[model samples]
Target: MSPPAYSRVLLKLSGEALMGDQGYGVDPAVVTRIADEVAEIRDIGVQVAIVIGGGNIFRGMAGSARGMDRATADYMGMLATVMNGLALQDGLEHHGVPTRVLTAIEMRSVAEPFIRRRAIRHLEKGRVVVFAAGTGNPYFTTDTAAALRAMEVKADVILKATKVDGIYTADPKQDPSATRYDRITYLQVLEQGLKVMDATAISLCMDNKMPIVVLDLNERGNMRRAIMGEHVGSLVTV
Candidate 1:
């Protein structure tokens, strides 16, 4: 078989993705399914790194809007991501895939600290590295951390998994006339204010020339198909 199109990729997953129709918290079934998909890609010689968000358990912006201290709320949000990371690590390991959880906040007891070289080395050795703690700082979203980590790790692309099929003119669920774009440019996403990612994340990707494949995570085999360059979703580039 031909080699997969991407040797290394960063998967950006929202914590809400782990909730699986539930009100809050992770669903074990959902985690296992994602782990199986990730393991499939790894078995094909792909190096996978993940950066997960924390909107399910806690959302910093939501808390801040409700009168909590912004910084404190953001910190709590980061901790939520760490919990999701650990849960994913468990699922991955249960699938017989070697996985590591690295945190930006230096929780040596639960995970290794985020060292760029160490993260790369883990991937080099065929271990999936899940980055948690949101860049170890408040005020930055995990999307930005994903872009930064992808650049630092020199990933071939970013697989930004979402609920929708791909980038659309408007939220497909809300707008009846919305049309999906099979391929879109970074600038177009920013100029149009599409919700592909935050401006900071998109700008970072645009500056670094990192491509992002936006696909529906709930769709089975989509991640592997994207890794194989099968035109599985919207491509954001340049």
Candidate 2:
């Protein structure tokens, strides 16, 4: 087999993606399918680290909109991510993939605290590290955490797995004339107010000269193709 294009990659998955066709919560079959794909990439020699969102179980912003304290709601969302991380870890382990869950917040009983060196070590040993807790701070999105972790671990790229195939001129679901962008710049994303990721996350990647590939995770094999450096999604750069 050919060597993988990237030695290390950070995959950003939203919690909603784990819901499959369900309205809420994780769908076991969907988690297992994603785990299998991760295992496949690992077998091909790609060091994988993941940062997952908690919108499926709890969205902090939504809670705040409904009159909840912003910080409290955000903390609740962080805990929800821990739950998703554990579920993902279990799925990966079931496929015989070594995995670890590291959290920004101290959750000694459930997972290890986030230690940059420890996370890098885990990757070096071929253990998939799942990062949970949105930087242990309120108001920060998981997208920012993914970018930070990717830089700390020196990941070659970030694969943002979402429902859409790529970044578009407009929301394809809502706009019939929306067009996908094969490549785009971080500045262009921000100037246009495109929701490829939050401004903070995009800025971080831009300053660090890191590339992000946005692709549809619901499509089987798309993740693998992304890791293999195929043109399967929109490439975002400085």
Candidate 3:
């Protein structure tokens, strides 16, 4: 196999991506499949870091909308992400891939606290570092955390794993005519109010010039193809 186009990459996975055909919570088979892909890229010399969301378990925004305290709901959401991190870690280790779960909220008994240097070190040492807890802040989404962590680690690109193959002009499921974008600019995403990432995340990437490759998570080999610089999904950049 050819060397990976990117030396280091930050993979952003939504909690829904882990749910498979189920309505809620993670599906073990899905997690194992993702682990296999991560191991494949690691074996080929790609340093991987992951920032996972918690919508499969809990979504703070949804909780808040249901008359719950925003901050408290968000904290619970963070804990959900930690659960996902541990699950992914278990899967990766099962595949014989060295892995670490670093949480922004500082659960030392379960996992290491988020330290910038420590995360980079873990990646350098050939360990997949899974960043959990979504920036340890209530207002911020995991999307922002992914962008922040990617820039902090100086990653070559952010591989955004979503259900759809790429960003569309509209909701593809709702609108059959919704078209896919092969490549798009950050400003275009914001101006059009596209659902790629939240505005904050998109703006952060735009300011820092961090590229984001949006690809389908359920499709086998899609992640590796994106990392190898193939035209497998939509490329989002300045």
Candidate 4:
């Protein structure tokens, strides 16, 4: 087999992806499935990092808009990410994959504080690192956090796993005419208003020249297919 397409990568998974069929919180089975996919790559010497969103437990922006304070809502969302991070770490470890969870909020007892250098060291040592908490601040999404962490860790690409297979011209479910582009320029995504990621996240990734692959994780084997550069989904590059 050829060498892995990337030696290091940052994977962005939403909290909802962990919900499996039940559609709430985390489903151990779903996390295990994801971990297995990751372990496959890990065994091949690919350094993996994960940044998970907290939408399944709580979306700070969504809650704040409903009456909660924006900052408080975002903090709660960050904490929720911590929960998801722990779950992911546990799931991965159960599979015998070495993993570490780092939190932006500095939860000493449950996890280590987010340290860029330490994270890189972990990856260098062949341990998967899960970045929790969204930038350790309010008014930011975990997507943005993923971008920032990707850049900080010098990852080759950011793999954004979503419900959709790829970036579409419009919501595929709502519009049958919507088309999925195999490759897209960041400029095109920004100009066309494609919903691959939030504007802030897109801007951060684009500014850093960090390539991204958007794919659907609900499908088995897709993640491995994606890491192998098998034309699995939309590729966003400058």
Q: How close is each model in CA RMSD to the real structure? A: 0.6, 0.7, 0.8, 0.9
lDDT of candidate 4?
Answer: 0.92
Report lDDT (CA) for all predictions. 0.96, 0.95, 0.95, 0.92
- Summed over model 1, clashes come to 0
Cand. 4 TM to true fold: 0.98
Candidate 1 C-alpha error for residue 182, in Å: 0.8
The candidate scoring highest on lDDT is 1
Overall local distance difference test of candidate 2: 0.95
Per-residue lDDT of candidate 4, residues 113-216 (tens digit): 99999999999999999999979999988888999999999999999999889999899999999988999999899999988878888998888889999998
How does each model score on TM-score? 0.99, 0.98, 0.98, 0.98
lDDT of 3 by residue, 1-238 (tens): 7778999999999998888899899899999999999999999899999999999999999999999999999999999999999999999999999999999998899999999999999999999999999999998999999999999999999999998999999999999999999999999999999999999999999999999999998899999888887997799997
- Candidate 3 C-alpha error for residue 203, in Å: 0.2
TM-score of 1: 0.99
Backbone atom clashes (below 3 Å) for every candidate:
0, 0, 0, 0
- Report the C-alpha lDDT of model 2 over 115-187, residue by residue, as the tens digit: 9999999999999999999799998999999999999999999999998999999999999999999999999
Badly placed stretches (over 4 Å) of model 1 are none
**Residue pairs of candidate 1 with colliding backbone atoms:** none
